[model samples]
Target: MLRIHFTDADLASTRMARAPDALWEVAASLHRFQTRAGRWAYAGWYRTTHARLREQRLDRIVREVLLPLFPRARYFPDFLTPDQSSCADEGLDAALDAIVSTPSGRVGRELALLHGYVRVPAWVRRLTGRQERRDLVAAIRSYHEVAVRPFADQIHARLEAGRSSSCRELLDGGVQGMLAGLGPGMRWQHPVLQVRYPVDRDLHLGGRGIRLVPSYFCWGSPVSLADPGLPPVLIYPLLHEPIAAAPASPLTALLGRTRTTVLRVAASGAGATTGEIARAVGISPSSVSKHTGVLRGAGLLISSRHGGNVLHTLTPAGASMLRTDT
Candidate 1:
């Protein structure tokens, strides 16, 4: 077992071990870090939430913690030399996912600050309103001349239980297999993907029962922003029911195209029929129905049938969207 302690007001790392208790403890500490960072991110970006922050935080931990610990004289001396890729490849997206997927706290915090800090230089450089991009990458080399690595038991346990076959499996299982593979004489095939050091000299090992792979957060590529192939970055909405009922406007992007039509159709005061709305908006009756459906979806309007004719009236959302001198 391993233990690291912290207070409510701060997040810091104080312990290390190559055992189950220790690795998981590191995980918990990192999770707290992620939670705290998430709060900051939420406050910084009004529309963001905790879940999204958690992923980024975890990524940072791997970017910083795991990479720094493996080399020195104290651990992993036996595994480096001949084989490389025994470690994680170095990149923001790769590092973040590697740690957070552990679903641990301590590791999460360490990772967030680590990645965030490294990214700072580049981010700062890119933001001066000057057109530019930043670059931050380092090579993955074995922390040779060392022995023993973090999470010895956790890694061994996973290997013993099976799950150590490929790089993808290890990444998918996360800490479970990575720790398991953290023996001696083993290295990673993808250095850019995560940390690689010699666990031993003969082979790549560890990885068993890993499940929670962290989501990808790449600031470099515009195409990656909404890529489904990227691990899912969930942002749990904090609202309990609609906050003050969506500001009395249900739609997020209907301002330019539909605003005028909406106002003209609803101007009769008593509201308008579907045909009347189509005439007013200069669109087909079916199109009016579609717009009405959207408005209704937004909690902005309501529709009712009077015999063969249907009437549409403004709800609070609709009225808010339709503002005139009267």
Candidate 2:
């Protein structure tokens, strides 16, 4: 069993040295979901949507990653099915055609794991709070040690056989190989994908993964803790929906005037406090909360507290609305 130790210095370096300048943001976003109610809601919401882009991401990643072995794939889904119910039947139908015409379950299983990993139901978000996270950490850590290490070995072997010679080279090459193959639908740019093991990691459920894989292929999918290399594993890159959310109601459309105000306040590169937002939007703190609540319910705004102040920010959706309006 291996343990990945982190010194305060090491963590600080990692935080400062995050690649793509985006990991910091992702880490913060995830931190927000660690709260009590936040985690519960996230756990419930992620399951409903993780497959939104799996079809699309898988189509691309699978075709690219395994295409060298098989080339008959065509008509792959343009987007993965995070929540099959959320997708249009037209795209879903085309996906089936491509799926049926494609090769058998072996390759399908590997690629499909990513989709299943993404569909982990935001269980990590369910930790009661710091105490639960601490209580669960030991089990999770053990699983990570035993489960992910084997997959890392497999990945390393694949990398060495696939390319360059050093340990760093192997890590980089393997990660690049996997990420490169993530396709257009990969939601997160720098997902922490790997195999994990958890004591309760489901055995009977679909793709009871012990492997830990993360990607921004779908920003909506929550971060999960599991080892994917173990039994009942699923393969396939599942990306989130393309995020082309359009509110049918005029009030819902164009970020609504109320939402627009809240988002604008949050934009100045600094998140807005409820008090600040209320003053900016000319409403009571309660009213500011009402509007923000609407935006949050829509997944367009996210709230956090910095020091003594509660802060609000336009999520990707809210940011997009502001940008699109301009």
Candidate 3:
């Protein structure tokens, strides 16, 4: 179990990431490649990435460098994922910088840990060299382009949904409610929030607060930075049902062009207000309202009154449809 002790100031300062942390996604998604854990939830992505790596001739780099560094069983270096990142490229740069600037002592420690159980590849020794560090960065960039970017839209949609739910929880019940409702095994009990961690640990926030990051790829349990003194951050898996893809032609046939466009616009996670839909789909508000109404009737959207305006969001069915269209 992991107990995260929070102060009053910590509660007040807690906030969610505005967008997905790119490095974190890369780190967490590696589990899919290592095991069959999230196979059902990410079968499509796994199959696609598996083929892409082979097609792009990145199999060796992935197997030799990435797989060992991002093993499923034990700790990898925390520097591989920065505590926070503003954008994907920035995060990638930060991760690569961490690799390049790693002290030989830390590299030796991490290698000893990995080598304790798993078979350490001979080439991993190059990690401490400057030229080899650049090669590692190139491998990461190529792997991400092949393995992650293809499913970027679906990943973004998942993050946006999680963010919306978290924001709503924060608004309705404050930090306590939001914390309590994080996931199945998470419990917020007064000064400390408990998680069903794989190992026993305790984290004292020490009034520094913590950043709550919702991850599209993190599975089973929430993860935190290994170093206790780093700017505190907790990455929890998004409670997303695996959206099943279906034939888009049927929906297109049923709704026709403009209404189908509206459905897709809503599913794009671009702030699903009628006006936002209007602006996004290049249609008037009246037309957006009319189309959203039909979609709501068809069980593709759910609309709620938000003060004077109505917010229309995609239903699970609608999200499934969009995911299928991809």
Candidate 4:
């Protein structure tokens, strides 16, 4: 377990990132390609992403160069994901610069860990070389464009949804409540936020508050920068639909206005309870329960009991049925 020791000052300064970090998504998406864990959640996007990569002949290069460097293992280089930037290209530029300028000692150590999992290319050995740097940058940019860019709309929607929900957590419960509700494998007990980490570790945040970054691609448990000395930030997964959603024609046609609104409310990824949905749609709990039962029966939503309340979220089909306004 990873223990994040927080001071009172840290609580005051905790903040959520307004947007997704591009370079981090690139890394996380690569991790997704190697697994079947969350396949059901991102099925639609996964099928198309693979086909596009293979068609462009980018899959081989990505597998050879990028995947090895950013493996789903313990020690991906921190420089590959820079602090948030206004644009993906801007973030990529900064991250690439960091890679090229990384100290040889740190590069060797990190790469040694990476090499343990996969063979490192000869070009990767010469980190500071201009030609090698250019090659690496081009490879990352190509992969991002081909495999990741097509789902930009879905990514943005998930980021926005996560930010909105996080804001409500902050308002309703303050920093401790917000942290506790981050996701599974996380708990907040006063001064320390505990996580079920892959490796046991601890973070002593004396005063510098941690940045809570919501990621569309981060899966399983929340991930933190390996080096504790760096500025503290936690990258957590967001509940997202696999593909870009179209307007719910079939659902709307089948269910009428009120029930459709109820499904749409569940699809918001907020895990709202019955009462919350009723309040949002101006209906009563009994009415909300009726709508939810029908939706769940149709496999459009799933409700889980959380203490006295039940929280609802969309299933794969449910997410596909809903429309996102880009």
Candidate 5:
């Protein structure tokens, strides 16, 4: 179990990443290749990514350089997923720059720690040299471009939906409520947030707070930095459901134009409230509610009540329909 000790100030400062962390996504996507545990959840992604890697002739690099460095073990070097990479504005290029500029001494220390858990290739020792680190970064960028970038839209949609749900949770019950609803593997027990982990540990966030990063590729247990002193972060898996292969023709056809517009508005960023949908669709609030109720009944949308307002977001089935329609 990993117990994260939080203070009152820590709770006050807690926040969620506005967008997916690119480097963390790279690490988590690599993890997907290493295991078959949640293969069904990512079957479509797995098939496409695998084919793309082979087609791009990047499979060798993934197998030789990337896989060894990012093993699905207890630890991987913290330098690989830098704190700067978590910024919403800074993207893959900035993240790669951070990896290349990481202090050699810190890199060496983390590499040594990785060696403690698993055998690292002798070539991995060459990472101490600036040129070698640059080479590694180049390979990482290639791997991400081929394997991770192609699925950017799906990833963004899933993240937006999750962020909407989280925001509603925060408004409805504050940070603690948001924490409680993070995932099944996590439990919020007052000062400490207990998480099911491979090894037992405790992280004390002394008012620095922690960033809750929702990852599309991360599965099973939540991941955190090995060292306790780094700006705290917890990358947890998003719930994955198989998207339907067929288009949602019947549902959309039955709803006609206004209801269809409401569904589209609800599918927009972070979801929409009844008022937001009404304004966007130019319909009355009662009409918006009637439309959403029918969609919700069909499992096309999910509505959560937050005091007087209700937030509505698309289910996976609904998202699939939008994808097909577009």
Candidate 6:
């Protein structure tokens, strides 16, 4: 378990990431390749990513180079997932630049830590070399283009939904409620936030605060930087609803005013709960449920239960249809 001790000041300063952290997503996505623990949730991505890697001829590089460096084990180099504050924005280019510019000493030290956990190839030491770092960055960019970028719309939609949920929690119950609502793996006890983790450790945030990053690829327990001295960040998985296998109805079939309003609500930055949707559309909650059922059947919305309420967000197909209609 990871216990994050927070001072009153830390609580005041804590904030959620407005966008996905590009490098952290890369690390977490690489981890997906290492385990089948949550394979059902990522089955579509797994199959397509495998084919993409083979088609791009990056299969060997990923297996021999990336996997060894980022084993889903106790430690990996922190330098690889640079603090987003150092980048101009959360774009992959900015992140790649940060990785390329990582100080050689820091890279060497972190790699040494990784070496202790898994066999580090002698050539991996060359990452400290400027040209080699650039080469590695190039490879990482290619991998992202093929494996991660294709799902950008889905990722953005999920992050937006998550942020909306967190914002509501914050408004209704303040930071404590937001923290407590951070899915099943985390518990917000006063003065400290306890997280299920692979190892036991304590992090005392001395008023530097922490950034709560919601990641699409991250699964199971949340991840934190190994070195606590760095700016504190907690990267946690976004809740993924299982994709329904029902055949989708055409967009033309979903043009009713009420259904259109429902689609818009799901697309909104502040995603709607079933009760909220019923209120918005001036319909009964049971009527709203039937509407959401049709939307889910058409692959236009995904509903997941949070606490006692069910939250709805647009699937990529749903968002696309909303966009085309508008």
Query: Which candidate achieves the best TM-score against the true structure?
Result: 5
RMSD (CA, Å), candidate 6 to true, equals: 8.7
What TM-score would you give candidate 3 relative to the actual structure? Answer: 0.79
Candidate 4: tens digits of C-alpha lDDT, residues 1-326:
88999999999888887766778888889999888989877787688988998999988887888887888877777767756432445666677666667676776776666667666677676754556767887888888887677777657656766765776787899888789788777889989999888889999988999988888888888888887887888888886443322355565566777777777667665756786576656678998998899989999899999688887888887777665323
Rank candidates by TM-score, best first. 5, 3, 6, 4, 2, 1
lDDT of model 6 at position 213: 93
Off by over 4 Å in 3: 84-89, 245-291, 297-300, 304-310, 313-326
The whole-model lDDT of each prediction reads 0.33, 0.36, 0.76, 0.77, 0.86, 0.84
The digit string of per-residue lDDT tens for model 3 on 103-180 reads 777776667766775787888776767777778778888888888767666676567656666777778899988898
Instruction: Report clashes for each candidate as comma-separated counts.
Output: 61, 47, 0, 0, 0, 0
Model 2, span 202-237: residue lDDT tens: 222232222222222213322221332322211221
For each candidate, give its TM-score against the true structure.
0.22, 0.24, 0.79, 0.75, 0.80, 0.78
Prediction 1 TM-score vs. true: 0.22
Better of 1 and 6 by lDDT: 6
> What ranking emerges by lDDT with the best candidate at the front?
5, 6, 4, 3, 2, 1
Off by over 4 Å in 4: 84-89, 116-123, 128-130, 241-253, 256-266, 271-326
Error of 5 at 279 (Å): 22
Candidate 2 accuracy as TM-score? 0.24
lDDT of 5 by residue, 103-170 (tens): 99998999999999999899998898889989999999999888778777667766766787788789
- Show the lowest summed lDDT stretch of 10 residues, model 1: 216-225
Badly placed stretches (over 4 Å) of model 6 are 85-90, 246-326
lDDT of 4 at 133: 62
Give every collision pair in model 5.
Answer: none
